[model samples]
Target: MPRWFNTAGPCRPDIHYMLPALRRLPDVQRLIAQEGYFVVHAPRQVGKTTALLSLAQELTAGGRYAAVLVSMEVGAAFPQDVGTAELAMLDDWRNAAEAQLPPELRPPPFPEAPEGNRIGSALAAWAKAEPRPLVVFLDEIDALRDETLVSVLRQLRSGYLNRPRSFPVSLALIGLRDVRDYKVVSGEEDRLGTASPFNIKVRSLTLRDFTAQEVAELYAQHTADTGQRFEPEALALAFELTQGQPWLVNALAKVAVEELVPDISKPVRRADIEHAKKLLIDRRETHLDSLAERLREPRVRRIMEPMLAGLALGDVPEDDLRFVQDLGLVRMAQGGGLGVANPIYREVIPRVLSSTAVASLPPQTSTPWRRADGRLDMARLMEAFLAFWRQHGQPLLGTAHYHEIAPHLVLMAFLHRVANGGGTLEREYAVGTGRMDLCLRYGPDTLAMELKVWRDGEKDPLEEGLAQLDGYLAGLGLDSGWLVIFDRRGGQPPISERTHASDAVTPAGRRVSVVRA
Candidate 1:
């Protein structure tokens, strides 16, 4: 049988082209060797389960430890019921052992105990029955919430002193975040804000995304297997776009080879990847949609809203920053500033944010924006957008829930409607930048746009916007662009009364279409 890229679940080496899942975290084995309990957390579908599964197999195959990877996700259903969660968890553990380990390595039946003590009791029984030291990888440990989450972590911490004689020699909590970010339902919001009970953990480590070279190596595996080579430029572009995000790296190639250019003798090109990226974003597969779902989360919005609008991230908690980083939504850039992890994600964020507003747009909204040759007519598009904004922008703003970036979202929705299928709408915004840059590419023409907001007590921003946009247009090597300044003051007039446009020249003498709304 032939192998292919695995996207939906844990990778099986026998069937999927992959790098060693455990290679990303070299400390796991050392920590386990020292009998330490630690955490392994990363965003969804980045090979957390695959790494644990591979590590378990490697450890158990060494004939020194009896290791198995199980999931706490089964306990997620009984968030408020400690007893039921423990029961479901233990039941699943047994079934998981049967499926993941050989008979000689499998534990004896779990011993019964009080509801609060069931998990500790079960692990004690398993450790006692096994001839070898046992290691347990509990994947999705953060999936449990409230009392159930507290109960499990407490049980694990309680069992820490027993070592190999009465408890697993070493344990790992695997999930999307550290135990600190695990939901314990502290107070008002259903978000994590408190510390964890699992203080016994030695370290909370994250699985880093693949490096640029690893991405090349992984893609080369597909080339070696199917004789369908990815061009060098395609590989580099893939790394650039995905920033070594494991799922996205594989997903882009999977789409390119399987859907775009399946011929074994042919090579995949950079254009294929660009097309695949658009497809992936458009399709909003389960993985990307899962990311989209987080856009509404308060913790996520606290960071993303400001970051998206290119304004200062004021007073955001470090926990919030770490949580967002853990969710793979943002990362520290080269200069120690925060940034969206990758180019594809940069595109994904605004598109997802603008989705509702896009739907709110009137029918045939793009008709006036296109020229006879199917090109995006810049003047017409801007004129149409100004007219549309005067008519319906305020109401459509309600469709976008992020108040800080509502105006940006509304405009993106209209542009998305213009560039949806045949073109690309790319965005570049970061914290403290005070503006969002947009590159709308349709047909052979590209439109460079800068978006700024006129908040209460702020300067008019016209001169500053033109200065900033001059540099932006210079970067794009364009002789002209558009600068849109949105008036978001408290007592601003109605859209129809205030929205207008005029022509201006930047410091570089670039022709800029200036729109004030």
Candidate 2:
């Protein structure tokens, strides 16, 4: 039987083309050797479970230490009922140990103990009864919340001292976030102000995303198996789109091979990759849908709203920023500013965010925006957008999740309608950069655009916007484009009065269509 890309769960070496698990996580063995208790965190589907599971098998097979990987996710089902959570968790650990370890290394039945102290007492019993020292990896530790999470952490902390005899010699808490980022909310609307109970952690390490070389190697496995190759451009484009997100990396390849080019004799190309990307986003797969759900979170909004709007993120709490970063929604950009993690996410975020507004658009109205030759007529599109801004923009703004970026969303929604069937719309926006750049591609034409906002307290952005768009256009090797400035000043004129369109020449003599709305 042949193997394919695995996206739904941990990659099995026999069935999946995966990087060497231990090679990716070199520090785990060292940390265990030092008798340390630590935390390992990474974004979802980055292979935390796969790495630890492989390490456990390798350690137990070495004939020195007994090791097993267990999960605390069952405890999350009973958040306030610590007793029940403990019992379920212990039962799971026993089953996991039985399946993964040999008879000599398997733990004996857990000793009876009270609800809150059950995990600690059980670990003590296992360590004392077993001949070999025990090392345990506790996965999904962050899923438990409120009293349950606190109780589990306190038990692990309490059992930290009796290493090598009465307690596990080394333990690892594995989850989507570091120890400090866990929120223990016990009935209060806000998190507990008390200090964290799991302070025994020696270090908090995160799993890094795959590098470009790793991506190429993984793809080569497919080529070696099926005698089908991915074009060099497609390979590089895959890395650029996913930025080494494990799920996305596998998903793109799976879609391209399994869906786009099912015949093994044919090679995958960049165009096929683009088609797969559109399909994935349009279908809203579970991974992408889950990310969209996080947009409603208050902490997420504080960071993401400004990012999409191309506004400066000011006075955001550091913890909130770190929390989003850990979730893999954002990353540090090339010049030290924070932005969306990758191009795929950059496309997914706005499309998901503006989906509601897109749905609200008028149905199938004919327009002169597309010429007889199937090219997008920029002047006509701009004129139609100004009319739309006057008629429906305010209502759409009122319904937007991020008020600061409402106009931007409304415009994107409109352009999406324009480009949905025959063309593509690409967006570029970042923190500390006060303008959003857009590239709209129709059959044979490319339209470059920049968006800015003019607030009441600020001076007119016309001169600055023209200058910025000039630089943006130069980079794209384009001579002319659009500069859209939205008027957000308070006590301003009516929408119909304020919305207008004109043209200007940039300092570099490139003609810029300026739309003031």
Per-residue lDDT value at 188 in model 1: 20
lDDT tens per residue, model 2, 1-517: 6888988877888889888877777787888999999989988888999999998998888978898999999989999999999999999998999899888888888888988999999999999988898999999998889899889889988899888799999999999878876768732124433377888888888887888989999999999999999999999999999999988999999999999999989999999998988888888899999889989888899999998888889999887888899999999866688989989999999988888899888786686798887888887888888888898887888768888888888889988988885888999999878989999888888899889999878999999999999999999899999999999999988887889988899999998899988
Candidate 1 error regions (>4 Å):
186-195
Q: Which RMSD values do the candidates have, in order?
A: 1.5, 1.9
TM for candidate 1 is 0.97
| Per-residue error (Å), model 2, residue 338 | 1.9
Evaluate model 1: give its lDDT. Answer: 0.89
Tens digits of per-residue lDDT for model 1, 1-517? 7899889899998999989888889898999999999989999989989988999999889999999999999989998899999988888888989988999989887777988999999999999999899999999888888889888888898999888799999999999988777877743245544566787888988999999999999999988888888898999999999999999999999999999998888899999998999899889888999998898888889999999988889999888898899999999987788999899889888888888898888787237877788877787888888888999988988998899889999999878877864788889999999999999888889999999999899989999999999999889889989999999999878989899999999998998899988
- Which regions of candidate 2 are displaced past 4 Å? 186-194
Q: List the residue pairs that clash in candidate 1.
A: none
In candidate 1, residue 354 scores what lDDT?
85
